[model samples]
Target chain A: MKVTAATFTNLSPEWILLGVVTLLMLIVAFSKDKKQYLAVTVAAIALGFSAMCAFYHMNETNQVMFMGQYLITPLTSFLKFLTCLLMLAGLLYGRDFITSRNMQPGEYAILILFSTLGMLALISSNSLIVFYVALELLSLPLYAMVAMERNSGRASEAAMKYFVMGALASGFILYGISMLYGATGSLNLNEIAQQLQTTAVSHRVIFIFGAVFVVAGLAFKLGVAPFHMWAPDVYHGAPNPVAAIIASGPKVAAFAFFLRFLLDGHNGLVHQWHDLLIVMSVLSIVLGNVIAVVQTNVKRMLAYSSIAHMGFVFLALLADNPIGYRAAMFYVVTYVVMSMGAFALLTLVSKAGAEAETLNDLKGLNERNPWLALMMLLLMFSMAGVPPTVGFFAKLGVLNALVHANMTTLAVVAVLFAVVGAYYYLRVIRTMYFESASNHKPICLNWDERALISINGLMVLYLGIFPAGLMSLCQQFVG
Target chain B: MIQQVIFYLFAALLIFSGVRVVASRNPVHSALFLVLAFVAAAPLWIMAGAEFLGLVLVFVYVGAVMTLFLFVVMMLNLDEVPRSKGFVRYLPFGLIIVGLIVTLMLNVIDPSHFSLHVNAGMIVPQHHSNTKELGLMLFTQYLLPFELAGALLIVAIISAIGLAFRGPRARKVQDPSAQIAVKRNERVRLVNMEAEKKS
Candidate 1:
């Protein structure tokens, strides 16, 4: 408990992230020049440093930092690495859009770094209090980010809706945690589980209610049906890069936390929660895919698509097996790649005057830019679960895990909904290739944008074809 | 005895201010009353043995956020609170919900089922400090959830930024065609005038 330089050294990664974020904030505050690239450079360097720290910590076995609230475990390290990479990509995509719109890049970068730090903390949190604090920390900044486009009414509406729903979800989660604490006289997940195991099932109704409420709150975060009302509006209203981060980073972290809390801590209650999850999974798959088919706005379509993907991931969770956990992780990774790629392509295709939100904007995209069109094709195909793309394998992994767990009916429903999802994804492809180019000139792509697009597109193919190693790693983690 | 006195005092203040917050006619006054409620609630949190939460509530809600709320309310000029017919219709439902909650609490805390004793096992000793024990338990046992909270905070931050930076479509005044078509000559015109001698 003694404060010393050595103790600080033990928390060097966290310090490093905080320090960089602080630096970015200062730069944003002091620098009058809007064209300053220092913030971007600092953000990139910080991301790289975090990645390195994560890599270093990956092999470290169960080292608790920050007086036990934070941990440096392989799971935390892996998630931190993935989140940092996604943040970096998001930052790159954000740069041109932010700058073009006269936004303060320094503040934007700093907030992103701080948010990323919060996410890392959340992923490594050891207590309910720490978890809630981190959740709030991550959430408060996103409310601001969603409202960052200060003048847009839609943006304001999106921010308002997101805030209200998020607050309600937080309330639900807090109430659940409090009820759990009241029931078990403890907030620790391990202790709660132990207590539940010992206590008579009839006496644990409060705990069960708490667990249900907590899952309901998490479902809101996951954009599962009955609580997914805000996803489409928020996703469509926010900037594309922001939408991409919303779709991937938070969803992945939420799933990670869900697995940690539910699968690891409450595995005994699998029978209790499994049916509920199965129901949610089925509803999410059906509703998300069905609604997405009719969306004219590209962002809204992807938002629904993301919801469907969450359903797929939920299907994996329903399996309640190691195979299921690994499949879920794989699905998240693949989904992130495809979602980022698709959004990145949208950013590239959008001209300065026009926002690439509608499907009509993609008309004749292939005629203007073959490379982008091809990239879009790959992403759409991947999303549609076509072969030779990562999405195909991602879905296959989830289905296989579900089948292994004797959830064949859920797997069938998933595949059926996936077919429904394919229609919308392919609609974009058709627009990109089959239609004639509009009279307007195609948007020019910057080098960073092109690089991201290509890498994201290629990753889908690479993972689909050579997924053995990654699958094994996931399996190891799932174990 | 002192702890009980402080708890009751803060609890009373919290309830009074919370009522005022909802019932105040002016939005600004309502926001101010909410701040008072939050401040009072912070002490109640401390009484509940959550020191961190108490401090956080004071710092975040009472100090910073409520100030922002006050500012926003002050800036927006509203003549009066909008009276809605829906409020009257929902009043019975609200009261019913409140009644149900009270009944539930009463059942849970029935004196016949459980008695409060000074030396009961459930009560902590006067000298016992919860913070240290809480810290230990949180770190040693509830580690993953603590980290997951951190990730949730990050997501919150991202969502906030997204909300703030949402583009203003209706108010935006950019015509790309006009901007792209403006020639250099049009932007930089050289006008020459002949000067005549005036007597």
Candidate 2:
């Protein structure tokens, strides 16, 4: 809370995003409906600068700011940088989709910017209150973004479902936080950890009770099974671009939130929360993979796949070592990249005449737009964890962490479920390549978008081959 | 002893009104019971030395928010709607869950488990002000969350407008600019005297 020079300097990225949000608001106010498209480019540039600012301040790590309410660490800076970049990519992928659908691109961009600001704050949050506020700031925009398609009754219903579930999750977290505060008389994560280390056995029971609720709430936000009821419905019902945004940066931010809550705040009680995570992870892998195979809608399929992927992240987290955390970080980063690329391709295929939602919409995509189909093939292959893609390495890293922790049984079960998960992703590829084209029109994209998709697709391959650099960086930061 | 008696009286009243707020069949009655519950609870805070919180809760929540709730409930005419019939079917499960939760809470909050760090009989000094202490903490140590909550409100406003706002309506709206641009002569015309013969 002190008005120090370091505080402003450290928080430059958030200030930049907040400034961009205000600027977008003014632009939306002044400009006519059609002219508000300019806000997208403005927001993209602001996000680029924000990411650059985060990278520039990467070395100023481990500095607890605002009376230990906020943190600036190398890991947080890296996650923030990734979140901004992913949001920028998501915005680009969504640009044509929003404008074509007559959804206000200006408002869409503003909400994305606000959500990104919230993610940045969530990544840096060091205390329970900041975490809760940042989480709400992150979620409120998403609910509106999902409901932005005002003409669609389905989207409205999806928004309602998301709002109710999100409210319940927030309530759980709040109630747990209140209990934790009562038990420890502190809000700062490190202070809570310190208190827990010395607290009596009787106090530990209340702390564990609070931690159970908190873990359940975090699992809900992460969309792991048993708490993942809203993901598929929201994904299928929301507009494509909003789904893309939901699938990307927010996952990374949610991982950071998990780390702050469990690793930072309640590390002393790992043996207790560890059991809860095990049940959630096993259920997520089992249910997400099993149910995803039957999905006809591509969005719902991706939603289920995301649940399975988060299960792998939780597996890495279960190892409870630096290597395990690094693997979890790597897995989340890889998942975000693949999910963003896949959804962006979905946005591209969806034309004006018909919303390309079902698997049949993607039938024989190879014949109509081979390049776009190739990009999608790469993304799907990556998602399925084929040998040449980053997804394989990400899964491998998680398994490695699990084996290192001597949880070979869980590792084997994960591998089994992953094999089941691969069937659906390959089914997407099979529909694109093996099936006959029904919608004969070719999907035309601007050169820049095509190139962006190309880079997104190739990054999966390139990172798979050269993951040593990012892997080492993850290791270094987690250390 | 008098303070103890007052505490138990209002505490009982608070719990009773709280239950009635949920159990009342009439929505207006429920809202009124809620207001009473808020009123009953404010005294507890004041008695606990949080005078500012107690007064503000009464003023802001009871006076403004509960009154607004009452107006909305009355306007909605919810009493005309029939209640759901499945409550009896669900009551057993609900009671079981509630019982379990109460037991767990009682176990965790058992007074014997806690070694009190603060002396229970400590008295407040003359002219002590918890309001000032609360303000100082809010503006100093807790400022990050305070400001973040402000930002959250902005997001709430944006989402509210984004979801609810439609474009300009075709219905007639006031033209404030045109209203202000009217000249004196335009608004009121001077005319020559034209007296009618009917007078």
Candidate 3:
């Protein structure tokens, strides 16, 4: 735990993000209107550097820093890399959408940088206190970002609802942590795990009681059903880019947060939390799929689909073994890529005074722009878990984990719900290809978004065909 | 016996203020009651030998935060909330839920399960400073959390400004660059004009 130059080197990713956030704040403060767009460039470059830093440290694992309250591991570093890519893509994809509407891109970029910092910190947090602080840091900016569309009443309402529910969730986590601390006399995850092993039955009950609240808070963050009341509204109401950011990076970070808190901290109480995850995942799969079919708004539909996707992650998580965790990690990374591509495409189709909010907005997209349309087709197919796409492999990995855990029935149910979820994603594809254009205007995208979206969309197929690389990487980290 | 008496006195006052905080009809009254609750609880903490926490709680919560709360309550121009008809309808269910919660809390906090010796007093080590110890820990063992909390505050400020700060759209602010970059001839036409009389 001694501080060293190597420790700083190991923590370069977090330090880079913190430095970038500070830089963005200063830019936002002094920059003129014409120069404000520079914030995006600055943030994107910083995110790229941070991501590179994370990738560089992939081999250096189990390096504890900040007095054992921060940890570095292969899995966390990889997650940090993914999160940085997510933020960078979100800014790149969101720029045109935000600028077209004359929103303050500077503020938007700074907020995203802060949120990225929050996510990185949350990913590496080893203590409950750090986790809670990082959670707030992640959330506060998102609430503002959701309300970025200042004129939209829907956006303001969504921001308010998100803020209130997020605060409640934070309260739940704090109370849960307090209870756990009371029971175990420690706030560090490793300490808590060790304490639980020797604690009495009464303390165990208290730990379980505290853990229920913690799981509930985590469910809210993950946007699983029974506590997913805010997702569809926030997604439907926020600007396209904001929703895309929320959907992509935060979910991955929340998954890491889950692993840190539950698996790392309270693994001793797996049986107690297993029942909770079972109920949540089942509800999320059924509800997310069944409700998504009726959603006319594309954002709301994606929201529901994302819920169902998280259900699959939880299914993998419930296996509670290395293979299960590895599958879960693979599933989350692929899902972030797919969803980010999907939302980026949505931003492309959106024009001034006419957002691509409905299915009809996507009608005849192939006639308008074949290349973008093809990318959308790939994303939608991947989302529906069609073959030759990453989503299929992701689902296959989760199901394999489930079956390996001898939960064949659960796997069967998961596949059934996935089929139900496929209906909506396929509906999107049908709207894009089979139907004719209503607007008849060609979809336009800048080179940056065009190239990024193409690469993102093709990744599904690329990883699907050669799943070994990412799969083995996940196994290496989790194992 | 005297310590027990003092503890019971403050505990009762704390519970009374706490109930009043919820039971008060006016928000201003409720805020005052909350302040009272904090005041009552501080002495209870002090009686338990955590005098530093008690003093800090009074100074921060009562002296500063509650005053800010009162200002907000007065400025918000909120109307009196009318009682809803559904309140009476839900009374039975609410009472049942309350009873269940109380029972659960009692089960969890059953003092009989704990081994407690009701000593006459808590022994405080000579020259032991709670504030100094807490400060040392905050700067050393707990520095990460302390720093992260500061970062969280900074995030809160940024979010508040980002969401609530209405800049050029709300007010006509001066551009210093434009002011400083002004060309003398362009800004003021130096055309020779005939001297006009007072008319």
Candidate 4:
């Protein structure tokens, strides 16, 4: 509980990350205006150094520090490490996009790093206060980044819309937290859980209402159906590189928050929340997929697809077992990789002034650049949960967990929705292969962007074909 | 007692000002009414012995935030926004929603229907002052959160700068720094010229 040397050692990842943030600012301040290339180098090393620190601490056993403010375990450490890798991939894919748009590279890289730090803090937080602040830390920079393309009216509109809705959601969460505090008189999750055990039935109802508010707020952040109204607009409006980070980075962190809050804090009332999650899960999958089928804008379609994908992740949590947790972890990790791959290709194909986003943009892509088209096909296949891809294994893992928990009917319903979802992903593939572009010019991609996409695609296939090792590894953490 | 009467006065005025805040046609009036509502609510907090919170509500929110609200409201072209219409037509639906919410609030708050006994009346603790106790706890156990709040402020400032402040765009005057880039060979050319005749 004291501020000892062990506390410093245990939180070295965060400390190193903080140092990198300061170092980044100094580098930006000292550098010339034309030396924007250094931003990528600084960011890469910052992410690498922090990831190394996290990886170094990966084998550590669970330890509660800062008087239970942060609870670092092997799982949180491992997820932080993976998130750093994902951000690194995002940066690589986005490097050319940033260069073309003349985005302030220092600003872009630092926001990404700060958001990553927020996620790491969120992952390790054991108290609601810590989690909430970390959530704000993650979102504040993102709002600004979403509006970074200054010339576009749509970008500013998206930013304003996101900021307002996000504030409302945070209000809901704070109200819920206040109500929960009134009921239990504790902000610490463990203490709340303990107090909840002896609470009367009437107080339990109050707690349930509080928990509902909390879930609704979180559902907004995760971009589930009904609360997912902002996602399509934001994704379609923001610059491609920023949109990629929005889709990948925050999603993984949101899933981490879900695990921590539901499993750790509200696990005592799992029965109450299980039905709530099911309703949201079913609604998200059904609505997200059904609406996605009609979308012509590629980015908007992917946004809806993300909603459905989130629904599947929620299904794993529906069972609330160790196996279910592992399955959810695997699903989220793979989904991030697959989405990153698709968006990277989208970024690569676009020029600065003309963003390539519509279905027409992909027409005859196969003829223009066969390799790029193939990668897009693979990414689409993975998203559609087709065979020999990570997406298939991810869905299969969650469904298997559902079946194990005796939810066959839910599993069947999910599979039906997955079939519906496949239609949209296949629509993308069909556009790429079956049609020819009216205004055709081949995409010129830098080697870095191309190599990043290739590695991302290969990762998806490799994880799909040999998923057992990672699956069991996830199981080892949650089990 | 006089305390009960005063409490009722604050509550009644708060409700009145709160309604006017939403119903006022002029945004400037609405902002003023909002400040009034906040002022009314603060007295109730003071009556509960939370003097620090009550005073903070007045100073931080009513004094500063409401003034900012007025400035923002006035910054917009007020002539562009037409006065709202259809108040009577929408009244029935609004009433229904209000009725539903009142019922829901009553359902949860009715302690007599359940054994749950929330404090319906104010009680002042005798051992310590309100602000003193809060300061003690905030400085000790909640120190990290207090620091994190400062961090949130920093984020807000940075975001505001990033999103809103693009420095000095669309200069009507020629930039001297840009003019400095002109070279003699680029800006001027020397040529053999024919002498003009007097015409």
lDDT for model 4, please: 0.83
Lowest lDDT sum, 10 consecutive residues, model 1 chain A, at A64-73
Best by DockQ: 2
- Model 1 segments beyond 4 Å from truth? A1-13, A66-68, B1-20, B23-25, B32-75, B84-199
In Å, residue B164's CA in model 2 sits off its true spot by 1.5
Give all TM-scores, in the order shown. 0.83, 0.92, 0.91, 0.90
Question: Model 4 over residues A191-292: C-alpha lDDT tens digits?
Answer: 888888887876687777677777788889889876888999998888887888888888887788778888877656787888888998998999889999
Where model 2 places Cα greater than 4 Å from the true spot, the runs are B20-27, B73-79, B85-100, B113-124, B173-199
Docking class of 3: medium
TM-score of chain B of each: 0.66, 0.78, 0.78, 0.73
lDDT for each residue of candidate 1 in A1-479, tens digit (9 for 90 to 100): 45568556545556687778756666755776775588888888888888787777777677765455565668777888888888888888888887776665666677677777767767776656666777776666666677777777897899789989999999989988887886777766667788888988765777776777788888898899878999999998887777777777777677777887887777678878878888888888999999999999999999888888889998988888888889899898788878887877776666345788898889888878888889899999999999898888889989999999987888888888899899999999999889997745866788777888788888888888998877887876775
- For candidate 3, lDDT tens digit of each residue in A1-479? 35678977987887787787888888888888644777889889999999999998898748887778888998899999999999899998888788778678888888888888889988998988888888888999899999989989999999999999999999989988887886777888899899888877655776776777887898899899899999999999999989989998888888997987778776667777788889999999999999999999899999999999899999999988888898899989999998888888888889534888899898998999999989998999998999999899899989988988999989999999999988989998899899998788787777888899999999888998999999999989885
lDDT of 1 by residue, B1-199 (tens): 9998998998899899899888878788888889898889988887767787799889988889989888888888765687756998999999998898678656554453234541144566888766777787566555445544554554555444444553335877789999999999989988897777766
lDDT of each: 0.79, 0.88, 0.87, 0.83
What is the DockQ for all candidates, taken in turn? Answer: 0.23, 0.52, 0.49, 0.43
Using lDDT as the yardstick, the better of models 2 and 4 is: 2
Error of 3 at A361 (Å): 1.8
Query: Least accurate stretch of 10 residues (summed lDDT) in model 4 chain A?
Result: A28-37
